[model samples]
Target chain A: MTQFIQQLINGLSIGSVYALIALGYTMVYGIIKLINFAHGDIFMFGAYVGMVAITTFKLNFFAALIVAMAVTALFGVIIERVAYKPLRKSSKTAALITAIGVSFLIQNGTQLIMGANIYAFPQIIANQYFDVYGVRINLLQLVIFFTSIILMFILQFIVKKTKLGRAMRSVAVDKDASVLMGVNVDNTITITFAIGSALAAAAGIMVGLYYIKIYPFMGFAPGLKAFVAAVFGGIGIIPGAMIGGFAIGLIETLVAGYGSTLYKDAVVYGILILILIVKPSGLLGKNVKEKV
Target chain B: MKNLLNKKNLVSLVLLVIIFFVFDYLIKARILTPYYRTVLYWMGIYIILSLGLNIIIGITGQLSLGHAGFMSIGAYSAAVVLASNPTITGLFIGMGVGIVLTMIVSFIVAMPTLRLKGDYLAIATLGVGEIIRIVILNMTITNGASGISNIKMLMSWPLLFGFVVLTIFLTNNFKQSAIGRACIAIKEDEIAAEAMGINTTKYKVMAFMFGAVLASVAGSLFATTYYVVKPETFGVNTSINILIIVVFGGMGSLSGSIISTIFIGFVNMALQPYAEMRLISYALVLIIVMIFRPQGLMGAKEVALNVLPDFKSFFRKKEKSS
Candidate 1:
């Protein structure tokens, strides 16, 4: 049905955003083995920065996007250096708690500065739609889909072909071994954060453009859902994150479109529990037996 | 009886009685301001919650981020009881209901989660917690998000202070028990513990259930005393806030939890003027503590009176032959 196609479009648009965020989560988790809970906040930060770019400096939409991505990448590097780097040698609990702390700080700190009201994201790209055989599609949705796909391909290329990518992979496999091989584990981790954050920043800008709104608390739900996606596709796996992101997005969109909206969140969280229970290693993750 | 009548036990008991009366006098004589009483109330409540949480996180090394979900369940059930019968007897009934319900729900939750390790378990707990919150948000008894209100207050000073002592005693006793030691072994290494003939999952569930029991009692008190119960009261933010306190204080140290609670409670009270910064400050504290002192302020050291030098030892140092 046309209705199904229409819902699919909507789903892919949002799914692209989830995929972008999930990629970031997967990359950081792959490199550092930390969840990087603050990644969502970095996405939010990107949106805010983009807002400032347009409103204060009167930059064009593309320029603003670039600025957001660049600034957010730098921001991610800083967070890793300050909040997470010290605890790298410490317990996972400490790292996790610190990640949560950084998340809360960014959220509440933004609230204090921005106030609680929802702000309209700058609308530079005029909203337009096309109708074909009763299946109408928003131009922005297509834009989001293609742009994210291109970005994802670019990320894949970087990971597969670049020297830094090789270093990142080696570091992920064995930090001590990689260090002995002269990988510079710390810089590799920092670069991974930067790339992941930049991708999430792109997702942020697109989400704001798609929704036409941005709020300080907007990041939490998507952050969680993206985390689920990363886990679903098998965390620390790039391609898996992509597939998982689209699946969750489609599922969520379909649920909201057909079922009661209130249950949407419950359904998402339910999937999280189910996936974790069924496959703690995730869909694409290989089971590694624990050794004493 | 003989063990109960030991000198240390008697001294602690007498001290508790004396401290209770001192606070009782302050409340009865109206010497303590309402502001101070309110602060003490929250501090006591947080202490109770932290103690329960510590058993799972600190002592057992289980990461349970959904503790607030457990609190919400007990809180709402107890609130319903008090709404109908506003009496001391009702309070006990409410607490009993809370304990029973919390035990069942936590057991079911722990079944799947406890099998996993660290982050997976944390997310699963968070998922379950969020699911519980969302479920209550839609239920008829919960009255949705607006939640239940207009309950008669039953939180007397005696009951509040007594419950605090009871929770501490319970956690301390649990920590010293054989099962508690097994839980610790599991935390230290799950594989090794299982190899040592310990049923890892069973002991984990026991520790989790015991924690829920305490949280539920605290929740019952929260519903009765706070005179309100809403879904928002037990959200992820609230869980993180309580967790920050537990981690800030030493995880395995009861004295650290109590001391850290008092310290953070004072900091929050002082920040009443800047309400916006209050949450931000809590976030900063967690970050700072985790980064600078991941072992927590108290670590595993239980700072108690046993460490205190005797009065005679301070004055009679000359009796020692060199």
Candidate 2:
């Protein structure tokens, strides 16, 4: 039972990180209808950026987090403007292929620059633990959980209350109509990318902090699982992403704990295939019939 | 036989025969070098894989990313068979086993997975690929993670390219048939095809199973060539590499797939010294090409094979048309 609680906390920490990244995937997908395959790579890029901020720039943990977010946010905007924006009018497959290219570029380029070997994520946050009711919880887990909740709250507030959020929602619903309504559709899209990227950065940095090991390839597995989470929750639905992320995290941790970790990836992929078949609309998405 | 002897096809067939003989002679003479010969062999294998993938992704409009799973199925089955028999005849039997197993697996996979669309389909297939790799990783018969490397070594240039030819012939004929047209309609617009009574699911399953079996055939060749079968070799990267070839050449164009495979194969060979840049360049090429020309170099266009004697007239006609 103690082990169960311990695992649950760990799952929550990781789940929020997945949720953060899933938000980026969900938002970009919501607006552009492209999967933005580079998102996981972007998350990895953000982690590396945060690592640099602490190791090279000598920034505090919070400061590094902010720096990573800012840098990655700008990077995301540039990617949107250069890679995805031009292909917007073209086929979604083209856009998807380009997104994959960007993903490879970032993942491989990071390997080139950072080397393929895994490195100790600088202990910006010391590994300290606290126990409650015979269950141990770590400081980083608390940070990840609270920080994710706060960030999500802020995101919710922005989308619900802010004008940019309104523009984002409008763009998502009907881009042409939004344009007719005098919304700066391009600007909204860019900002949406920026916001999503920034959130990804936060997730990336927190992940680095929690795992204490950062590598170029670290993003691929979680990226995929988080994508499953997004799809599981109902793609393009923000809160659905959150729920899906937690569910995937819990399932993954439970499987690793009870079952052979060798089949961890297989189980996730199975769920992806199963959920996609059984509930294509996901736990939260509305079923939109295929149009003629 | 008469249809096979049509002017355009006769010219292409004669050209194929000449090229095969020339390469065969070069292999015998050791002129092309073993390294280049191996390159050509791999290229042929890649050609088969990409042609199959093109049938699924380009022609049939299903975004399948689990082809490597099928390829792995072929490769491991063949390797296991060869390990036991260790004869040319056994190798053939292994290939047969591969195709049968691939057919069964793909049929089961396609039945339910084909119902999804677009990105959902892509993710599901990717998941399926990962699952297959993981399953192989844990299986005892596959030697777990160490893989099955003790194959008897009975591979030949004729056998390899023969499969490539078969793949091309099948894909080409399939595309020329009513089934291929139905796939194209689905690619163009699935709902419209369904409205027209095209039995979208059945056609998709047919295309998927066919494409997967071709990959399985290529897989047998791949295992025989490498003399080793590891789960990692048939990972998502391999699947994506095949897709890259299909897209770079031109989706829905067999000739384009061939051209792109050769081009990318040679480029990879040239860039072997700079191993780091090979994938980086591929990524750049995909991004740049997608931005500039999403239809690819051929853009659903084929290289028209005029009779060899008409080379002069071909140029003259081009000049006149211009």
| lDDT scores in order | 0.86, 0.86
Residue A262 accuracy (lDDT) in model 2: 93
> How high is each candidate's interface RMSD, in Å?
0.8, 0.9
Evaluated at residue A206, the lDDT of candidate 2 is 90
Q: How close is every model to the real structure, measured as TM-score?
A: 0.95, 0.95
Clashing pairs in 2: none
In candidate 2, what are the lDDT values of residues A1-292, reduced to their tens digit?
8888778887788999999999999999999899988999899999999999999999998899899999999999999999999998998888888887898888788888889899887887777888798888888888888989999999999998999899999999999999999999999999999999999999999988888898987887888988999999999999999999899888888888888789877998899889989998899999897655
Report the C-alpha lDDT of model 1 over A28-64, residue by residue, as the tens digit: 9998889888888889988888888989999987788
Give the alpha carbon lDDT tens digit for every residue of B163-224 in model 1. 88878877877787788899889888889999999999999999988887787887887887
DockQ of 2: 0.78
Per-residue lDDT, model 1, residue B268, is 82
Q: In model 1, which regions exceed 4 Å deviation?
A: B309-322
